[model samples]
Target: MAWLLLIVGGMFEVGFTTALRFVDNFRNLPWTLAFFGSVTISMGLLEYAARSIPMGTAYAVWGGIGAVGTVLVGMIFFDEPSTLIRVLLILTIVAAIAGLKLFA
Candidate 1:
C-alpha cells in the first residue's frame, strides 16, 4: 500500500512538472492551478508513503519516476528531442528504479 502510494505520488510529480511548462510563468491561471494542485497531492502522497518506506529509497524512486515520465511526456506531446542516448538514459533510470524496488 505504501509502495502504491509512492508510485501514485511519483506520477503526480510527473503531472505537476509537465503542467509547469503550460504555466507560462504563472500567467496562465488554469495551468498554474493544476501545478499547485498536483504539487499538493504529490507531496501529500509522498509524505504518506514515507511513513512506511525509507526516506532515501522513497525519494530516489519518486525522482526517478518524475524524470522518466517528464522526458517521455515532453517527447510525445511537447516536441522535445528523443535521441538514442536520451532514451537509453531514461531506460537506465527505469532500471535503477526497478532495482531499488526489488532490493527494498
Candidate 2:
C-alpha cells in the first residue's frame, strides 16, 4: 500500500501545483485554500509513504509525477506550449519513473 500512497501523494502534488496558478498571488480565496489544503495533504501522504519506501525513490517519483502532471495541466488549461519535444521530454520522465518502480 505504500506504492499506492506514493502515487496518491504525487497526484496531490500535481493538484497543489496546478491550483497554484489560480491562486492569483494568494488573492483568490478559493484557489488559495485549495493550494494550501493540497499542499498539506500531499506532504502528509508523502511522509507517510516514505515510512515504507526508500526516501530517495519516493521523493524522485513524487517529483516526476508532479512535474509531468503540472506540464500537462498547463498545456491543456493554461495554454502553455505543447511542442513535440516537450511532450517527448514528459514521456522521458514517465519512463524514468517506471524505471525507478521496476528497479526498486
Candidate 3:
C-alpha cells in the first residue's frame, strides 16, 4: 500500500513538473493551481510511503519516476528533446529504481 502510494506520488510529481512548464513563471493561474495541487498530493503520498519504506529508497524511486515521466511527457506533448541519449538515461533511471526495490 505504501509502495502504491509512492508510485502515485511519483506520477503526481510528473503532473506538477509538467504543469510547471505551462505555468510560464507562474503567470498562468490555471497552470499554477494545477502545479500546486499536484505537488501537494505528491508530498502527502510520499509522507505516507515513508512510514513503511526507507526514506532514501522511497525518495530515489519517487525521483526516478518523476524524472522519467517528465521526460516522456515532454517528448510526447511538449516537443522537448528526446535524443537517444536522453531516452537511454531515462531507461537507466528505470533500471535503477527497479534495482532499488529489488535490493531493498
Backbone clashes under 3 angstroms, per model: 0, 0, 0
Q: How does candidate 3 score on lDDT?
A: 0.94
lDDT, residue 69, model 3: 96
Report lDDT per candidate. 0.94, 0.93, 0.94
Candidate 1, residue 8: the lDDT equals: 93
Distance from true location, Cα of 44 in model 1, Å: 0.6
In model 1, the Cα lDDT at residue 84 comes to 96
Badly placed stretches (over 4 Å) of model 3 are none
| Clash count (model 3, backbone only) | 0
- Candidate 1 lDDT tens digits, 1-104: 99999999999999999899899989999999999999999999999998898999999999999899999999999899999999999999999999999998
Per-residue alpha-carbon lDDT of model 3 for 40-101, expressed as tens digits? 99999999998899999999999999999998998999899989898888899999999998
What is the TM-score ranking, best to worst?
1, 2, 3
